[model samples]
Target: MPPSLKPHLNGWYRSLKATSRSGLRVERATNQPLAALRGALGVAIALFGALALSGPAMATSAALGAQMAGMATFQRSYRPRPWLALATALGLAVSTFVGYVASPWPALFLCVVALWSFGAGLAWVGGQTAGILASMTVAVMLVVVSLTESVSQAAQHAGVIAAGGVIQALLVLVWPVNRWGAHREALAEACASMADYARRLRHDPFAPFDPDPLMAAREAAVVTPGQARSRPAELTGVRPLVERMRPAMSALADPRVGAAEEGPERDRARELLAAAADILDMAAHTIRSGVSPKIPERAYAALALPDDGPILHGIARHTALRLIGLLAEVHDALETPPDDDSPRYLPRPGVRELLPLTVVAIRRNWTWRSAVLRHAVRVAVVVTLAEGIGMALPYGHGYWAAMTAMMVMRPDFSQTYSRGVARLAGTVVGVGVASAVMVAARPAPWVCGALAVVAVGGAYLTMRAGYMALSTLVTVYVVFLLSMDGLTLSRTAAERVGMTLLGGLLAFAAYAVWPTWQTVRLPHRLADQISAAGQYAAATLEAFASPGPVTRRAMRDALLDYRAARAALRAADDSAATEPVRHRGLRPSQLSDARAAVAAIGRTSMLIEAHAPTATAPSPGAAAFAGVVRDQLTIAAVAARTGTKVDLTPVRDAYQLWSDSADGTPDEILRDASILTEAVTGLEESLN
Candidate 1:
């Protein structure tokens, strides 16, 4: 066997293993009983309302609308549920009407499918919720349009579907269940994460903490004007304080900067950390429950510090004092009265303002290098090909093949292949189970509708339990919904399974022909992260060199950008891990060391931020040193991406100049600069 062929075979083997593992794993079930019940209620109303008013045929359309809309509510988004339902319903109605109009001309309909699928793929720029709902529009078009014969019939079907979605949205408005639950949970989780981080730092001073919770909380904080006005007081000001506390705690515990590794100062730092963990836990509980926290006696005693002045001196003492003040601020913020009208820190863009942003986002992602664009092209090509092939086949439900292809394919190699396998397996099992039940029971049309409602409700409840479970239930729901039209159970099941297999295989083949391998993009992702981290570090140093509002704001903004870049790189790495391709620009060991080096840069920056100087005069040579660090890291980032070597001679010379000219600089600033210099050196070594 040729060596080239061996690598391809090995890649396929690894891909298969990853696909099996992810496709079959069941996630831990979250308790969302009220949310599940509310969604089920919407399905019930849509299903039974159409059955009573119209007939079994129209009931299918209404049920489809409610089920899709209901599924949107379960997405991990903070948007209002009513709006989500309305948007989904509107998309379904438009898609259904277009599909009906074009069905008479097969060639025209295929073109329409291609265009619609492309748009759906591009909708990912808006977010996961938008993308999934957009894709469902395509699926609804393929499935529901078959029931209509004429343009007027199509309008009626579309209206009823819109009404079903309206029913769900109306229920969300009138029969609200735990309003702002997602936001509260997100904020609470962020606080709880910090609490956990504080505890970890008690053991390991430099323990790494995942910033995902804080990122999620920030997402949750973006609310509409009305939501902002009504948001709980505790949730308003606590996040910023929580964000500041993390860096303060980290700096206070670092032996090189604050407390000695083994001394009375270290003991005091541990005590302070323990108290902080307790306070943060209390804060999380208060935010989540809207109740005042019960501070522990030990925590109170620890927070009191020493009555006869603090035991620690210099920066260590200052950091401890600052931490206590921030904690007090957090406590006061949580205790804010309900009538308090503090302005929101995050922007609250209404629908009218958001539309332009969405348009700009779509326009920006229209480039060839964008993953979304690539995915869109893949979808258009595969769906059109699948539709053409399905039409040529002996099966009656040709659209099922196209629908399967649309559902299984994603932008990334791992998800597309894994979901393809999972969808096929789930469809087979779902079809078989539903068929057995229908064959044995010989249920009436009403019974079929009832069973379909139950299946949809089960799907909603098990959404977090992995795609396989949800797919199985959704397939069962679809089968039962179709059965209401008196379709034969055995034939329907056989056709569904066969069409699903054809679609899955077509999708897999299409992706294999034109895949966007994440492994190849890892270097670019790492380069972006390194650049962002350098900017963040530079911003922090600038703030230290000249303490003012402008520099502070820049520091904050840079930190956020750094966090986002880091998250993106981590996602790329995870996706690359599941791919079968060989490493491209950076080898595994080089990538690992590079990540550690970047992390060190971020940690050092946080330490500087933790001890921001308040002197009126600028620190000598600090601004120049900041520029040097930024320039060096920028070069290193380019080297990472271009597979070139990074030189650190200029960086060493700049560090030496800064050190020699630090006669008037604060001792804390000098110490932090030294740490930053070492971090940059580490980065140079990792890159070269």
Candidate 2:
């Protein structure tokens, strides 16, 4: 083999292996019995209602609508469950109507499928829930519209489907199984993560922590004005304080910044961390249960500074003091009165307000350079081609092939390929199992309806248990639904399997031809992370120079931006790692070094943030140094993306100036400045 071909072959091998492994992996299912029961009840109600009013044919349509809407309720979104269900239902109804209208003309139907699939792909900009619901709408249209003959019949089917969605929405509103349940879980999980972090820091002061839980909590914070007014006191004013506690805890534990390793100060630090862990656990319980925290007496004692003066001195003492204060504030925040005037951080928009945002999101992804646009085009072409080919083939129910392609394809290579593999395996197993059940029992219509309901409920219960499980259960549900519509089990199973293979293979080929490889975007993502970290560092320094509420708020906002950027970069890197593509801009070593350097810069900023002074005294030359740092990093960010070396002369000069003018600066401020300078120097070396 040629040397050039080796990398490509290796990449393909790795990606294929990952795809197979990921397809087969089943995550542990989350125990949500009430939620599962609620979804099942919704399906049952829809099924029985349609059976009594119309026949099994209309009942199948209703069941599909209810099942899809119920799945929306399980998505990790802050939107109200009823609204999600309604949105999903509306999309399905519109798509079904369009599918039926276009079905008569093969060319026109292909065009309609292309347009709908494109829109579905573009919906990813709104987030995973929107994208999944939109794609499912396409699948629902393709499947449900096949039952109708005339325009009136199509409208009737669409109306019945919409009614099913309405029933699900109504059940969600009236049943109210766990109002604000997701929010509570997110906040509680974040607190518990902090507690765990604190405990870990006792042993490894620099323990790595994933900020995903806190990020989830922040997402959950977005609430409509009405929900904001009625929000639980425990949920408000607690998260911000919790965010501050992390840096403070880290600062106190670090030997370089706080207490000396293996000394009385270290021992004291461990005790305080243990106490903080207990306090955090209590706060998590309070948020989860909406009850007053039962503070441990030992935690209070551990937090109390000795009356004979503090055991730790300087920055370590200050950080410990800050951590203790934050802990107390969190406790108070948890115990806040229902009528407290604490400000809400994220106010969710109403439907009217969200329309413009949605439009803007779509417009942003309209450019040819956008991955979303590429994916949308890919989806349009692939689904249309699948439909065309399926129709050409000597087979019945050509829409199944189109539906398979719609469901399997994604913007990124990993997901599209993995889902294709999973869906194929899942469909085979699901169809086989369902076919066996049908052949053995030969159940009546009502019994088939019951089985469909059970399958849907099982799908809901195992949602977190991987895509393969979801596909399997959904396949079973579809099989049972079609069984009620008088389809021959053996023939249907064979056709279903064949069409799925056709669709899956078509999707895979389409992506191979026009792929959106994450590897190509790595440089841009890295640049973004670097820029965000620089801003965070600059903000932290500015806060040190001018300690005030405004500066502190800026620092907090910068911190959030930095975290988000880092998270995005990490996700991009992980996806790119499994993709069968060549590195485009940065070599592997350069990427690794750049990531390490950026991480170091973030850590330095975090250390400074830990000791953000309460006093309003300005540190000499600190502001100038911050400006230089920010400017240099901005240039470095550009350099990173453009594949050029960064020049750190300006930053080095500014650092020297700051160090020379440090006579009046606080000892801690000077120390942090030196660390920041070293981090910048490391970044320059890494980039070069």
Candidate 3:
């Protein structure tokens, strides 16, 4: 082995020692993750039982209304919050009441929900869906069969479900886990290490940043607690897989990670992120085909940790597994080729990242004025139309339609259409199943229990995938649970189906009429990514031209800004939020045009220091500096396509001084380093 390579390779690995965030109190003492997940499961099951007993529409309505009320607010960024007293009453009402109606002051929620969505509304929606849907089919005993046959049953069911959810929230609170800095540190360390791999690929002049590793690394970097908008208390009860990553969130200070990355290694590292960028192009195709075989192994390979081989005990393993499972499901779908009418399930990628950072992410990524007004207007319009329709009809089912409309509205466009369809289908299926079971068996206590189990199972299934089929199942199960007590299974199913159809049609129609404009021009947006890469390359040149103090700070700030910008670009690329809007006005293709630009930038940055010319008390001038930067970028571009660039510059740093000159190495290197140092420090700000 070459002497330099050994330390180069081991350098990153050695930095994995667990470290504390010097001077932090209440240092996020977290309980075991599996324990918390199990506890949440238990609570979700208990609520499912209560909701199934809701016999009539009113009972289900009021309960659902109350639960919806609590759903509107949260206390923390992550889920599984301490149980709030409000949650109990809300759950009980929603689960037990059938035909129970609560007039939602649309104006209030319209504004609030719009903001909430801009915050953590999307993640909260998924969590609540999981939590509330699991509580389905139990209202037969909890509200419907046991109580007066009135619409109030809806409120009762909602109350019990909310209660259970609240309990689950409390469990998350005191059960012990660092909700703040320590946890963030751990996540940061993991990301930095992953970034190192990307940096390596970015700099390898010989090898273009392998899209596989870059894609994998970027995908891994998806979630940061900063993205979630809701209170931590509200987010705690939903997707539990993310909670596992909390421990490593505090390990951000590990300097070894993303540091050793240079030259070819740096190029490789950037490619890892680039691959993630390519997913946007591949996503629709992948989803439609239901096969993601294109996902490269490098994406998974670099993420494997030495501690337990990456996919073992850590949260990354679980997330990776989730990806594999999703791929398998997509593969199965393609192979089987299900009909449009048949059950279809697709994974909701990136929710784990969004779960905790919901609000901050929204504030950072989206235009607040547009998000609030667009969402609020859409929701309000949909509600008013539904109410108008109800008032015109003989029945008072307008409330149901109104409620469904509210539930389906969203600021995130990716799943909005899917949600509407799912709601419509599930309501039909669930109501039909409930009505059928009621007619056949009179929905005795045992039958109710059986249905309750089905709801829990359905909820569990839904948790696994965000596909419409699972949504259908949840819809069926919840309606069945509510109608169990009413003893009118078939009719209830039909009504739910109708109500869901009404809501789905209204929400989407409203959205289509006047939706929030896409954030940026797709072509320009994609092009900007290349521009950013260019800037990143230029910054690298500055770093190369500088000495210790200047280089360190320049590299640090440049990478920080670059990382944030790159992340936004990638999210637009791979996340469902951006892909479906492929309209004639803006063709959102895989940004191949900018691909070369970014690759050149990432790779050049990695190689600039390597290519910098060095001499004892060397000259300091624009010509010498430009030669290094110019040569590095050109070589980085060439190496990306041709394989690697030759770094022929002689090393004149202290390490070289000690070995070759045997004199005051640090002093000697510093004495001659002024030119490079000043060049880098002065020029570093151009990219920003």
- Taking all chains together, each candidate's TM-score versus the true structure is 0.98, 0.96, 0.49
Q: Which order, best to worst by TM-score?
A: 1, 2, 3
lDDT of 1 by residue, 94-157 (tens): 9999988998998999999999999999988988888888999999998887888789989988
TM-score of 3: 0.49
List ranges where model 1 is wrong by over 4 Å. Answer: none
C-alpha local distance difference test of each model: 0.87, 0.88, 0.40
Task: Rank the models by lDDT, top first.
Answer: 2, 1, 3
Q: What are the per-model numbers of colliding residue pairs?
A: 0, 0, 181
Worst lDDT 10-window in candidate 1 = 336-345
> Model 2, range 1-688, lDDT digits (tens) per residue?
9999998899889998998789878899753878888999999998988998899888988898999999989988988889889989998999999999999998998899999999999989888878899999999998887788899988988998888889889988888877888899899999999999999999998887778899999999988777787777888888888888888888888898899898889988999999999999999898888887899999988988767767888788878888889999888888765455555658788878888999999899889878889999999998989889878887667788999999989889999989999999999999989999998999999999999999988999998898899899999999999889789887889889999999999999998888888898898999999999889999999997888999999998998999999898999999998898867678889889888888888888999898787676787587888898898999999998999987888987888887887457777777877887888888888878
Colliding pairs, model 1:
none
Question: Which regions of candidate 3 fall more than 4 Å away from where they truly are?
Answer: 1-162, 170-373, 387-392, 412-414, 445-450, 516-520, 527-531, 549-554, 573-591, 609-688
**Native-referenced Cα lDDT, model 1:** 0.87
Q: Which stretches of model 2 miss by more than 4 angstroms?
A: 1-3, 341-345
> RMSD to native for every prediction?
1.5, 1.9, 18.9
